[model samples]
Target: MVSSFHVDARALALVGSHATCETEHVPETRRRVVAVVGPTAAGKTALSVALCQRIGGEVVNGDAVQLFRGMDIGSAKAEPAERAGVPHHLLDVLDVTQEANVAEFQRDARAAIDAVRSRGATPVLVGGSSLYVRAVLDPLDFPGTDPAVRARWSAELESRGPEALHAVLEERDPQAAAQILPSNGRRIVRALEVVELTGRPFTAAMPGYRSVYDDLVMIGLSVPRDVLDARIEKRVAQMWADGFVEEVRTLRAQGLERSMTASRALGYQQVLAYLRGEIGEHEAIAQTTAGTRKFARRQERMFRKDPRISWLDVDDHALVERAVALASSA
Candidate 1:
């Protein structure tokens, strides 16, 4: 099923707090950072624009792919016309050739929030990327790396297979090993590096991830499972109709295959498989839809883990009214 943001306002207020410093200003106060989160095709972009219209706020791109240039159609990125004159940050800020990560996203997003507040406008973060959500709203407790530790793991990954090294972690820290997939060379290596430096499993040491926003308001959008699945399929179809294959071809022609991470994103990955004749057009569409559905499920799980987000099971609901009320009270 699609995500159900059944979390009430009271639950949100009670659960969204820790003993950390009160960095989140009061709603209607200066520098308010409101977050809009949900699964794919859940209408977050529309809600964000609505919030901006009512609250004098600006939109910040929190999705991972929307950062890259020429990555528009496949990313399901908010378009210039769809944005409706809202000032957006972090969209099209990187070339497909440049690698971007969570740290960079956090830094850029925080700066955008600060800048919007300086201009006397509220800052509203909008997108489905939950890691980005946690990085800014609730940061995980990942310590700065020791270069020696990182180097050690890096060297090992080069010489030894990831499985052999992951076996080493499975002995010392099974929890960390389980979390790091064998296919995920980067995260697996980082997990082992953290283990070497701190002598503690990375998974075991993750309890310190805390929310930085005080009195923060969150509105999550959810649709029924079947409805969301249909929406995902429809979106994939529309993307193809809107020239998604051409986008992939252009990126490939520009040598963007070197940036495998960007190319592996939802539609692009399936398109590449089709390009290589590994899959036909029908299979490619099915794979992309299935992958998107899976990613949406992951997004739902991610949002549910954050007690701060009160899920809204949207149907024929009046979101603008709810959003306006939240903004006014905030």
Candidate 2:
């Protein structure tokens, strides 16, 4: 990605000094970068579109799951009609069989942001994935992976199942084990890999409050837990009604089961379990709702720790107006 701005000694001398400029300057000529973040069903998409409409901004997707094509219904991707003519970037950049790497995503998202700004448009990064958002806007780095160690873990995962591997993680790194779900075999393996190579806990290398960019504006949508739960259940019902099962069925026929990344997505995983006769349709819907509620709680917990974000109630009537005011001030 290109630098957002260039600093020159001559310009610094004219402004007083580098220290003074760092303390009090926000160049009006610099392009704005804003992020809309929150839990699932908190109306982030609508809020982002409204912000873009007001500020002449373009949307840059920050969700990891929304990167894949043919995984739309489960990912809750923004339909073209819902985007309100705003040019959205990076919606379907990968196929279902492709694995998503955060390092690659950081590079791609930054390029998209630069492209948006090059056209004199604000880049509004919107999604619920905490790590993806941080990877774009924060100074986060992925640890190097050893192919031999990774292959060993992968073979163990294939033979013994995720639960068995999770047990191993619990013995080695309890804190990392607590954060990752037992069923998340991919993450569990990665965490163990990091522990072996770096000689440190996996959580120690995670992103903190250190941001890579200056003048970044983060707005978080806040909702009551009960209301958010109701919204998630309603959204899951709507997804099912929209033939999400059929969408997964189509992808399954095209090697979804062998696709490690796409197969582990929320709705698709549950529906796949139902299709395999591991669970019924009713059980699938119920489990999806329960899992979504849990995921929302985790999202809230994650975002609350970021001190840079300004939180607003999603139910407020003046949400858009307040967000516009915040962006204008930035």
Candidate 3:
């Protein structure tokens, strides 16, 4: 019994190795790369920590929300204690005001994975953001950002509301529009700005979103929708209890704008409204839960579209065992 492998179109182009390369290349596979992806509050952190401990792998973050500092509870980021001494990369490395893109994340994550290999350990990327995970694992592209164009688009967004600008994006870059929510004004505007500046659809210019990483084992943790919804609600409660409001308050004190991605995170947005007396805390919780559920659905859809991912349930032992099996086989 042997595992067969074949080169895909991208790999054929990259390596120029289309001489009838059959599904028979597995025995000579290079190194191993594994990713753990799932929706928010679906035990990504616990599974990741267990995998890291079991496999002596270094963890790299793929979730966009995990990059911002002071976002512990809401991001469901691993606490220092909860990390169980596993070295993690790319989490809590940026301020709420800083911008992080897939291209940058890909570069950084690749370097981190290389470092882990150098240390004779496996590389495990963990997150729910399918786009970011794919950006790292596959050789996909990220559209370049033109500061000037983005500035202009942002001004338009500020004056016209995200819906109006999203309509323009829908006209120019329908694919990007479909992927990025109109409610995600920053991303919507950025996609449209890239298309306008480069005279290309944003997808065509994405340099980091498509790739052919043969050694990668991308695992996705998918919970039942109802179960995930309940988890989201419970996590929101935990987030508030863990001082998520004060975290946003500190960020606000430092002059975080609603436009910043960190400020725009699911729960933070509604909490900001509450802090500003625009809504009550109860309303903030309810709104945040709803927003998280919506985001989770989108995340699930993104992962579903990727055939490379192996879906798994979030059982404690199963998650650890699957990751271990993938890494060991790699």
Candidate 4:
């Protein structure tokens, strides 16, 4: 039986039609940007590397968490040795104390893609961050913000907690609230800010299936739920064994707890809880695995909403070759 997560035939047709339309309208010299996307632990990195080797591409980091300078083991960032001499952009762009803004990332990523193309290399975007990837590919715009209004929401989030603020968001924009996690206070605050600023639903700011890039091809990796669950468990176990706790400890000393964005990443959050004596070590590991599984589902759901992606199973032996062919044709 096919999983609901699989891309439909209509999506495949849309991708084909869009590629043809792009070719006709876009300048012949414009380059195509290839996005390798999937749920966590689905081998997006491996596939991206293979594609790069085949097409002489450079990698553009698409995962939000991997932007931090020192977050290695937890974010599964490709080490210098693992990158195998392929140049990577935006891997260590932010300090742990700094925040990651989607609008800024969009601008930086576009410039990186341009730079790669100028050097006669294909730009391959690889990561599990669904919105970040869309931010690069789609014509999405960020709403303007007032510090005072944002501060007020942040205060409310601190005093009343994220759940309470989320309740208010639910009352104002249920659709947006449904998509933003209650624990994700940073995004909740931003959503409320946009609603107040524009007097519109936060979801209204999201662009449709229109591509900002002249030529863009999105390849999604599909994995069975059971297999992905096992992968998540094993990945989390390896992270712990690789001293993820020690990595977090180093970051915490550098003010990771004070950062709004970096502090809330999957494994880092659970490890912080464990460090605070809120949970046991084993519980932290279990929670990380569970949270990752939940995050994987959200990633799949986000990508599935876009009708332009070509989904392929990760277990297929010819997966790399197939992605290369599709991307080249696109």
Candidate 5:
């Protein structure tokens, strides 16, 4: 049986016809910025493409990992064909060695949105990166980084480990520490840097949920936990079958490990460990699956806190129709 997540021919036709009759008539000034957000493997990509087709929109990538070059399969970045002729921005725009800065992404994404609007197309932001998505849509201010402070935290993380630094974060800002994983040394270091630089709790630096844009439509794909877990396992299996390990091997030679951000990506980290003989291939794949499941849960929880999102079941047969209606009405 075909999964409901797949956009069938009939649905595409309906969306295409709707685009011609309705969305095409809407003025560019009135165009709404549509954001397709959800947990991993919840079919956000398919929905984003379909919605763009129905709304004369361009996709602005909101996923952090997809920004890096050569980190394709594991990021589940849409292939050119999968994009269905829609222009996609921000994918493969950075080298793996460079860390993804959410503050920079906020500026870039808003610029992309403006550029799309200038060309008379709506901007459709799609990804599972909750913070990146929020950075683009919300009025969030990122604290400036002090190189000395950041370097000190980085040194502390390297010497004492992520957990030790995370413990310090717990003492300084329990809310920030609770939100960040103990194993995520980079994020821990960043949080610590922010705390030290601002002389305030890291969590206090974050803004409340409020969008800068008046016309914004946030569509969140909702998948049941059991189904999402199964989908994550299947996705990891597919990644392995699609040369994910080889991709990691190729990137490893390209200095993926030297990258503070890319090296720690879910599958890449596990596969690197496997290549280093720290774990077996089977264990690597297993860990990737388990880690991705946990990450998806976290994504869902973060997105759930925002009341602006219009949640739709991923399995809904009229998913595209409903999404089109939401965007059109906006």
Candidate 6:
């Protein structure tokens, strides 16, 4: 959670403030790094495209899953038509066999932002995950990884399972453990590794709410919890209808199960379990829906802690226009 002290007064004022129709063109000198953030299935992709069209902007992918190629349908990646021709950077850049590194993403996303700015366009960073977004926007530095130390934790995880490791994390850094799910062994192992390598609590490595960019505008989409849950169910249903299972099957053949990050993705993980005869297809879908809802709640909790975010109702009819006004005025 980002501290309230980092909130930008000018940015927060955009929450309910109105802007005239003529306020379409944001001066290049005042162009801000606009971020569209919220829980999953909250219409962030649509909002991002609308903002880009309204403000001569390009998108820089902040969602870690969207960075991988061939994982499109499950990741909810925007189709080319959905993007509406707005140039998107960092989408489909990595193979499923590779891990998604936050530090690498931070470097690549910042470069994309600079490149977009050089082209006289605002870089709209769009994603649902809080850490990935902050990695690009905030001055957060990740602790170095030790392969041997990481291996030790990984071996322990395989033997004792994620819950045991999470118990350990809870004892060492309760704050970090509370934020990460017990089922997520990869993140748990990484947090434990950080704790050991830094000789401090994992939470201690996380910085306060301080952004690297001065001209930044964060727009959050607020949805009722029930509505968001319904949306997640609908989304998971649509993914199945869109051959999500087939997509996972194809990726699995290409060594997706060996990849630490890609294999653990939301729908992919449950689907993999089903494919391996661990569960039925119906159970897979149910788990995906339930897991997505849980993840969305976590996303909302994390975003709500950031005071700089100016939130608007997801159902707002004038969302794009208002966001434009907010960005232009900021």
Give the runs in model 4 whose Cα sits over 4 Å from its true position. 1-30
* Candidate 1 residue spans exceeding 4 A from truth: 1-30, 144-189, 204-210
* Clash list (residue pairs), candidate 4: none
The 10 consecutive residues of candidate 4 with the worst lDDT sum are 13-22
* lDDT digits (tens) for residues 165-262 of candidate 5: 99999999998997887778889999989888888987785677788988888999999999999999999999999999999999999989988789
Ranking by TM-score: 6, 5, 4, 2, 3, 1
Q: Candidate 6 regions off by >4 Å?
A: 1-23, 28-30
Q: List the residue pairs that clash in candidate 6.
A: none
- What's model 1's lDDT at 284? 87
Error of 1 at 274 (Å): 2.0
lDDT of each model, Cα atoms only?
0.72, 0.82, 0.73, 0.81, 0.82, 0.84
State in Å the error of residue 95, model 4.
0.9
In model 1, pairs of residues that clash are 5-311, 5-312, 27-330, 28-330
Please identify model 5 stretches exceeding 4 Å from their true place: 1-30
- Estimate, for each residue in 1-330, the C-alpha lDDT of model 2 and write its tens digit: 222111123211111111111111323423889999999899999999888777767788888788777888998998877777776777766667677777777877887788777777678899897888998999878898999999999999999999999999999899888777787788899999999999998878776697776868999999999999999999999999999999999999888887677798888889999999999999999988998889889888889989999999998999998998777684
Candidate 6 per-residue lDDT, tens place, 50-147, comes to: 88777777788788898778999999999877777677777876778888788877877787788778767788999999988998999888999899
- Per-prediction backbone clash count: 4, 0, 15, 0, 0, 0
Please name the candidate that would achieve the greatest lDDT relative to the true structure.
Answer: 6
Report the Cα lDDT for candidate 3: 0.73
Rank all candidate structures by their lDDT, best first, as comma-separated numbers: 6, 5, 2, 4, 3, 1
Model 2 is weakest, by summed lDDT over 10 consecutive residues, at 14-23
Best by TM-score: 6
TM-score of structure candidate 5? 0.91
lDDT pick, better of 4 and 6: 6
**Each model's Cα RMSD:** 9.6, 8.7, 10.3, 9.5, 7.4, 7.4
Instruction: Report the C-alpha lDDT of model 4 over 177-258, residue by residue, as the tens digit.
Output: 9887777889999999999989999999787787887778889999999999999999999999999999999999999998
